[model samples]
Target: MDVTGKVAVVTGAGRGIGHGIAMKLAQNGAHVVVADIVEENAREIAREVESTGKTSMACFLDVTDRQSVESMGESVINQFGQIDILVNNAGVIGAAGWEKRETASEADWDITFLVNVKGIGTVTDTISPHMKERRYGKIVNIASVAARKGTATSTPYGASKAGVINFTQSTALELAPFNINVNAVCPGLLWTDMWERIAVRFRSKDDYPDELTPREVFDRFVKARTPLGREQTPEDIGNATVFLASDAAENITGQALNICGGYMMN
Candidate 1:
């Protein structure tokens, strides 16, 4: 597939890693559909894409909503004439204490599955028909290292991401016949608003020990954990996604590439 002339849909493109991926794709000459639950951020992202001289459309999308996912898919097809790439990047961090197992509620579990796992399933399924018609597609699901091991206290998040990995493999097998490559990118610690929030949640508000802000602390944590001695930036994940979406990764399907700065070598 020639990415330069292709149309790509990216969920959660409001900010952070999703925004980074959208920007990279646009920079590489792909028309982008920046979908996000956060309306303002989504618009901002769309504008940013356009600023780079690429076509971009912003849409309010709640991935967990079947209607929303289907609508967005239709919009992409209507606007661009065909769908070439789909990036499932929208997800949520379950309410605090969701990983306590016994304390985790059914509602929390359902939300995690709904947004983190099923959301991707919904979007991909809706777009599959278009890809099948064209006999070409590239899907990059944003998973996390949490799926590979036990998160400190984010079990639901971890489990949902694990589901993402398994689902990616399953989808790849099903889509390969149509020449679509379905894969997942499991990002490790990074400097993003989500990471800052997680850091704040882990630290005591009064005495967090570190003098750094929550975002800084999150970066420090990644540096401490990874052999690379630094956190993986959104740009890092963006580059990986571009490679996966390009013909360079045509032979790479049903795979989960860890962009975790060597944090998880397996």
Candidate 2:
């Protein structure tokens, strides 16, 4: 687990799981590049990393835009010399609560695919050249359980994540000869901003126990579904990320690891 001097680029690392991953990598002595669409949040995490006595840089990145992703990669290369790890953690929960595929408009599908699926392609493609040249890299993609288990109202999100898993497999196969390991981490519901938004959908309409906040309700749902009897946290995801990014997982690639507390046994 010693990652001293290793450079890591974590996308959408402003808050939640991405932020936790970046912080954990930094804590482990990696020179972390925190990339986010929100520049301010990225800078905030960079500051936090510095406070922890580690090297970090904040970059404004739009993973869906090829130019932006390339420019961010350039910036990291200029500052850090090389990229050793890339974490595709930036994603969206496209059209939450609208289960009916027939009800989802064309625009909804486009936006979801652009950000969740194509964005991953853009960033990974931009960084692949660098990784290939180095002949060593570790890639960790953030997929979701919805990708494996199709959920109601999750068509766009699920489809995009399923794409991520396949993309990881394909990319891993291609990068293996170059000594790069590509894998994915599938996370179940954690207490992130996305969940907060999802919670709102049930707030006014659903009749539940009076003692529960929307978050508590969501927690109860997970506890009932997950055999682990508890909800996941950003830290749980982060720890898995750090391990996957480290040499400890060097032999593991093209595989999707579920951090769902056995919510979906496969």
Candidate 3:
């Protein structure tokens, strides 16, 4: 899996899975653009990428804000000339620990969709036309295994991911004729800030109990749900992402590849 001399723009790349993806791409020879809402994080990641002997730049991107997204998009195009690979990794699982399942507010739903769903479209719109002009591009959307099925825990999250899968398929078709491939990666359990929040929600349940710490709750879920009995890491997701963005996956598009440890298969 190589992306030598290519240009990749990764959103939410300041940390976690996004950081991993940026590093992997740079390690594989792609000049990376570390775009994140947090300018400091983006700058830090960009420096990290540069330290690996690859050229990189930092861009501030708020996926929910068109102006912010557009500004970053323009900056990347101006600096790199073109974006050969685009990874839509910016997303949110908006829910409060206090909010009950049946009582999920419209505010939560709106924010989740705005970032997880519409955000992808906005970023793609800004970047894809350039891809079409060049008739070459690779688009990867970071979805979740939750998209494969519904979860009583976070209704909006699962639904937003499901929407991501659908968007991947639809955009794949639209961009295929232009020689651009679009795919989705449905990552399994990866311990991140988002998962920490999920763990907090789990503790609120009757089964988790007060004695069970967040890590313990997360471990219990990972052991029960993952057939391989191993937690998925940012590096794992990064590997898959680099593969999809590389020429090895030129023919693959409009598909959601599951990165879970056999926890989700469809």
Candidate 4:
């Protein structure tokens, strides 16, 4: 994958999978723009991008807010002159704590979809016009294996990711006419802050093994669910995102590629 000299904007690029994507894109020769809800984190990642000899700018962004999305989009254009690639990586899994007998509340579902699904639309609405004008762009949405199948434990998150995959395809078809490739990457398992929450939640279950700590809980699930018997990394997701954004994938769109170490097939 080659994105040399391209200007790329990554939402939630401060840490975790988004951080990995920004760094990888820079390493691959793209000038990266780090956009995150956390200003300090975004700035830190932007400095790292610059340290890599790639141009960068940090923007405070809340993807759910149209104004925030518009502001970040404008800043990137003003600083980099163009946005060749956009990674829709900002998302939420909703509030974490729930007893085994309990289920996700309506409010949790609302907030989850607001950030994961509507947020994508907000940011894309801000950037797609520029892409159409140039007739060139690459859009990658960060989805998850949860989209492929639903679990009662995280119905909100899974449903939101499923929306992401569907939205990815719809946007791909629409943007293809303008030579913009839109795709989604379904990351299986990564031990980010989000995963920490997941592990903690699992450990709190009444039936869950009492001997297993949060990390152990995570490890057990990884061993059982991952056919590769290894945990997925942020870099793994980054690699897939970079490829989908590269010229080599110019002809590839409307596809949701799983980067889960064979954790979820087809």
The regions of model 2 sitting more than 4 angstroms off are: 95-103, 203-212
Per-residue CA lDDT of model 2 for 86-120, tens digit only, reads 99999887554443234566766887899888898
Please report the candidate that would top lDDT against the real structure: 3
Instruction: Please give the TM-score that candidate 2 achieves against the real structure.
Output: 0.93
* Per-model CA lDDT versus the true structure: 0.87, 0.86, 0.91, 0.90
- Name the lDDT value of residue 65 in candidate 1: 92
What lDDT score is found at residue 97 in candidate 1?
56
- RMSD for each of the candidates: 2.6, 2.4, 1.4, 1.6
Instruction: For candidate 4, give the lDDT.
Output: 0.90
Q: Count of backbone clashes for each model?
A: 0, 1, 0, 0
Q: Which RMSD does model 4 reach against the true structure? A: 1.6
Candidate 3: tens digits of C-alpha lDDT, residues 1-266: 98999999999999989999999999999999999988999999999999999999999999999999899989998898999999999877884543334456887898899999999999999999999999999999999999998876588889999999999999999999999999999999999888887787788576688689888999998998899999999989999999999999998999999999999889
Using all chains and alpha carbons, the TM-scores for the candidates as numbered come to 0.93, 0.93, 0.96, 0.96
Q: What is the lDDT of candidate 2?
A: 0.86
Stretches of candidate 4 off by over 4 Å are 96-101
Per-residue lDDT of 64 in model 4? 82
> Where in model 3 is the C-alpha error above 4 Å?
95-102
